[model samples]
Target: MNTPAALTLEAPAEHPFAPFVRILGKGKRGARNLTREEAREAMGMLLEDKVEDTQLGAFLMLLRHKEESAEEMAGFTEAVRERLTAPAIQVDIDWPTYAGKKRHLPWYLLAAKCLAQNGVRIFMHGGGAHTAGRLYSEQLLDALAIPLCRNWQSVNEALDTGNLAFMPLQDWAPHLQSMIDLRNTLGLRSPIHSLARILNPLGARCGLQSIFHPGYQSVHREASSLLGDNSIVIKGDGGEVEINPDTLSHLYGTTAGVGWDEEWPALSARRHVKPASLQPEHLLALWRAEVEDSYPQLALLSTMALALRGLGTPREQAFEQAQRFWDNRDTSI
Candidate 1:
């Protein structure tokens, strides 16, 4: 009878991300932090889909609750940078938009456009609808007639055409996007939320990061510095990278190993009134010169100033150049 051919089987090996999950999930005293290299390996497994769904979910939640370290963030960013398929295109500024704007119309989009018009090559990346009721960059970019690049080739083509390109986060980091999409189900964000903000996929000379939470401002600064990144992290308008016209902005970051930070006071003499509702057309109107609201214009000016500084302009001169660039921007484009 051959005894049913002597059944043979092998147990599946433990998932690559399991160790990370264990380190973070072990009871308070047992749990420990992952080193930079360990963080990198874990993130690589996530990007490569080498972890089980249950393991991935648990790992993310543990990381979220434990709070990520600068070492972990830098390591995850390193993994992302390594996986980026985009050609080494020369990008002057890397604008990573992850936090959605609820109270504003993403004036930073216009800021980037203005800079691009003045000859700075801008590469913007972001995800859509991760948070409910918040306005994302993709929606605004669509309204403004900017094409969305879904892959590296398209990003290069868009960059070549307009000196600006907006890539959706899902295109380069689908796994991270999956975690972001779990916002509603998870009822809380994971560390991927912060990591996505500082990925800088194309290795641009300067990166702009927007943080909604004040505590994260320091995390971003330390992580970016560890990665040798020339970048700025701002508590932007609704955390969308638009300098708030009504509040002082605490900027934290590094440029050529020189730590950079400042409390840029608000531009308005009186607190600006929040609009009843935000519309993409409002941004269009502002750019088209059909609307002349001081608040939005000041937002554009201040945001551009930071970008210019990130690009190596002196503090005083950056604002001046930003004003000039805003004035000369061909809004008709």
Candidate 2:
């Protein structure tokens, strides 16, 4: 059934969004669920700057508690794709957004440069790390002398020639970034953070993503399902696509014409274990020297490299390719 043409024309009165406020603001339980379509409509208002700030905050909190339904996820994805501002660019390189680990940036930083060495176009997006922990993605990038791209063209150049680009939360989607800034004012993370990961319009046709938490697993899986193929996921750290040595790396994927590989594979941690030769003191130095050597990465770098290579290339080749990239690579930024 079509939505009332009128609701499509104008913003719904506060009356329509007010109940959401009441339910979300009071932290109440058992509110009637918003239909998947209504949820999408609600997000449309938010992105079009139709919803007032108060209602906006309320709606986010409400959804956080009630949890997002699959249909709602589809609606949100549609709304964000419509709102993304990243410029369209030709895809010469075989890569998409590679979000770095915000909590610990070293491994991802290394992987970015490693992949860049191979001419695999890469772009990583994230605000910072530690949440409030004061450390962010920039510190490491600064250490390596890698700078942020202000324009999509520069990013394209980086991908075409060197294969690495870093875009922060501020670009691509300011509407969502505005909500992230509220972290300081409201002292909480809304669903906006999750939305940022799913809204990879930068290369929607070939965008890649890092799935961090168990909660986000289904969220990304279902949302990507709505998008058909064109999305890939790797378990990430703190919600970004950095590696974790403690666990196996699992790659979930789908492509435009090609469907998902039924034999979803896992890269065992044992194969990518941290070297036994390095002492604790050396380990400390390893972390510090990452910025200096451009080889700054965790043991999981090998696994991530192998996973990425498996997509269009061979796992063994990707692993060797990543190692060679890491060995000769210069953070010379």
Q: Compared with the true structure, what per-residue lDDT tens digits does model 1 show for residues 264-319?
A: 88888899888889878888898999979988899989999989888888768999
**lDDT of candidate model 1 versus the reference:** 0.85
The digit string of per-residue lDDT tens for model 2 on 28-73 reads 5556565556667777777788877877766776677766665676
Give the poorly placed runs of model 2, Cα more than 4 Å off: 1-16, 19-36, 91-105, 128-130, 204-206, 257-300, 306-310, 314-316
Q: What is the lDDT of residue 90 in candidate 1?
A: 85
Question: What is the RMSD of candidate 1?
Answer: 3.7
Give the clashing residue pairs of candidate 2, or none. 130-133
- On TM-score, the leading prediction is 1
Worst 10 residues of 2 by lDDT: 92-101
lDDT measured at residue 218 in model 2 versus the true structure, 0 to 100: 53
Error of 1 at 98 (Å): 1.5
Off by over 4 Å in 1: 1-16
Query: What TM-score fits each model?
Result: 0.92, 0.74
